[model samples]
Target: MENKIINFGAGPAKLPEEVLKEVQKNLIDYEGTGLSVMEMSHRSAGYFKINEDAMNDLRELVGVPSNYKILFMQGGGTGMFSAVCLNLMGRTGTADYLVTGSWSAKAAKEATQYGSVNLILPKVQKYTSVPRQSTWSLDPNASYVYYCDNETVDGVEFDFVPETKDVPLVCDMSSNFLSRPIDVSKFGVIFAGAQKNVGTAGITVVIVREDLLGKPMKITPSILDFTITEKNNSIYNTPPTFIVHVMSLVFKWIKRNGGLQGMYNNSLVKSKLIYDIIDKSNGFYACPVDKNVRSRMNVPFRIGCASGHEDLETEFLKLCESKHLIQLKGHRSVGGIRASLYNAMTIAETQILADLMESFFGNKKR
Candidate 1:
């Protein structure tokens, strides 16, 4: 294995070494242009192609159909929180949202600023699992239904695609984007912050259905309007050039690694091994997410205590850090441990983590 430390960071997470090497190679001079990607003008052909390639690769990777317009915008996923409301609020009285966890709750909160929000907080105690859809209180005439496909903070995920008909379905895929194959056609909008599976921070990706464009609510900013940005090819203003370039490199890496299906297979193996460790640990280590709805990309588990026990968890994290397994801390909202297994995380790294977990937990299924 490589000598570099094993990275388990949640977002701004690990990227493929091959992509890093390519970025390094182009850091100084990009394709004999005598300028780094950072130095190039956003309007220039070189930078334009970089943006186009990033979008095109994402489109192909997710099998985005002709109906969807891919836009690389600034302001991350939070931007979309307002953007979604601004664009769709005019259609109906309120927006419907599933309050699965923190991210979705934040989305619901943001939507309420523009209009009334009908938050569907599924009843499953302590954010431990996703409730069955039969129990979800979906609004029939709602402008749109918003949900976070995976909650990074609480480590809960929707194992099945939500069932929604004509009402547009919006998803905050920030924590779980591109970690597995998805049906792009089912949703009216899907947005992700680039920091997770894409490349770096500072950029957001929006895949909006073509039919859903053209009419933002009166309060919507011009830049936030999907139709306006789509018309301008996401170049309405000087876009995040450096971030887009890095995203393009990452996209190429994903293609090389066999696209979405490959990501699905790789994620399955890596996450399964880690979850297996947690599952077999008995009470020694416990995964908070319900087995039916656990996120394949983000796994949050408790070691040696209930909700209030932070000391032992911190010690375990420090021990893991000493061994070069980094960023296993859970989000502040839900205290425990979190292991983010993104596309760039290798199977071997997870194997090492499983071995460590085994060794640390008395070498027996707890």
Candidate 2:
């Protein structure tokens, strides 16, 4: 097999090569069941084992509390925006949202349809930094406190979990899920689309506190209702069998590679490699996010000042692509280069990108 390109794209990002190889080996027949995982019935014994193993491994890997139910549902993180409001907003007709970046802002907008949304922080200028918790205008009667733990587009991450007191803290952890250790008990609801760190695009993992269920708004669909999905073991309808199976393999990979702590260590090393380059570039590369609140998973940097450097940025992306370092371009909304150092990204891959950055900058200086 020819070598694979180093992928740094964001979602539908990169799966472990080992997991991909395993899937390739079992694509034709899954454990002598005479059918591919894709061909197997969702209710079949083999398929049931796959689902059970995925959930069990996930629970063990994350040390999820007994009170949390892990539900593997379809629809990406965007779907959960509405599901969160629908399920949690019935308790109090209002929700408090921290608009840290684009995703959180979008979440807040979606919640307004179901109930009142309190923009805890003022309108963000460019999503460069997360506002301090003290500056937030939180409402005591809000149903839940919502925020995106990692803003994939703007590259801002919450370094510390916010204390919501009695209110449930719901996080959209799509880009940074499984990249580090998290206290599961601290948050009432944690949901992530599997495309980032988990597995593929079709599956979304939602861990909801048991007590928070059965409280959806009257118009909530059966699929988006947490209580129905949890009671059905995340199979109220046919789940995303192939994606869940792949995610199960990923869970195994995480265990073999030293679990969550190991993933965290690797992420730090990878992110630091790029950030170090950006910081030392002496204005050649500039990261907009505050250093303390920078995301270890996604690092967005511009080629020059805030005004204009479109040509140089385009050239940098082209040069990186020529070296087989792909997907180095940032989100169009942000207009820069973003290096998404996800779990499957190895230190060697990061080093290659770092070396390219150094070479690119040196050439520009010369």
Candidate 3:
């Protein structure tokens, strides 16, 4: 524990210490296979079983029904933006997007190049809270309704799933994936990149309802097609073997630590410690996100009451680094501080950061 540093980066965030130690212990020889997972053939039984376990454990954790096929694809969430449009847009030629924050906005923009994308709610200058569903224009006949459950940038989160009735719902859960329990049956497709809460950054986990497979646009690449990945058991080509092994390990760790409900409870505690400090800080520490819609995974706040505190913000980040806290800087689009509380960041470590924020300034409102 000497010279320990906590990583609060949004992606490729800190992983569970136990998982890391396991990997370190087996790096040279995985499962007595006589070769590293990195060097093993993707077709080999060892790597294939690792891939299968990760998918099965994740499906159990998130409650994905038997009707959905889980595929481990490359290119993260950005690639899925194009794949979504390619696969589903042709079904109805138009999709509805609820652009709550940066990622959703980017997804909607990418979708425009493929088919008709209707922004149900007008874009806003400030991406603080999710707009009321009543204000949205619901296109009942659209192919699907897309939304980011938790926006990593902008710090806004949807507390409830949007009801599309008969229309399928697509979600990008890249940031908050596995942080809480979800009813997978409600969604047509649910995708998440592994780096945040699962493992490393080479792969993305996509769960697609079996009924929605095989109908991609003609331009869709075979690699990006869900049917192809599903048919091949998510190994159409050589997958990221090492990352998949790590993912499988992380999945077991989550299971051992009491599963999804356990993760959600820990999230509440870690996030509350930070929010409590901000709330008590008066105006010295300011959170740009709405109180109700604030994200548990990513908390973004400014240091000088949201106006003209650029110098103070920099100083604060420097001070945090001194305390062995890194990646607390907020996104450039919204300048401030961001504390990412992924699964691996322990509750005690979160307290250390919270205590630092508490001592940063007086509780009196500026």
Q: Rate the local accuracy (lDDT) of all candidates.
A: 0.86, 0.91, 0.91
Q: Which one wins by TM-score: 1 or 2?
A: 2
The TM-score obtained by model 2 is 0.98
TM-score of each: 0.96, 0.98, 0.98
Q: Give the C-alpha miss distance for residue 69 in model 1, angstroms.
A: 0.4
lDDT ranking, best first: 2, 3, 1
What is the per-residue lDDT of model 2 for residues 258-363, given as tens digits with 9 covering 90 to 100? Answer: 8999999999899999999999998899998899999998999999665439999999999887778888889989888999999999999889999999999999
Model 3 misplacement above 4 A: 363-366
lDDT of 1 by residue, 1-366 (tens): 544588898988998899899989989999899999998999999988898888888888889999899998887899989999888878885888888888887788888788898867644547777777888778889988889998988888888878878899999999888888898989999999999899999999999999888778887888888888999999999898988988888888888888888998998898899898878766788886778988889988888844535776877888888888899988877778899999889998899888888888884334
lDDT of 1: 0.86
Local error of candidate 2 at 267, Å?
0.8
The lowest-lDDT stretch of 10 consecutive residues in candidate 1 is: 305-314
> Alpha-carbon error at 160 in model 1, in Å?
1.1
Could you list the CA RMSD of all candidates, in the order they appear?
A: 1.7, 1.2, 1.4
Clashing pairs in 3: none
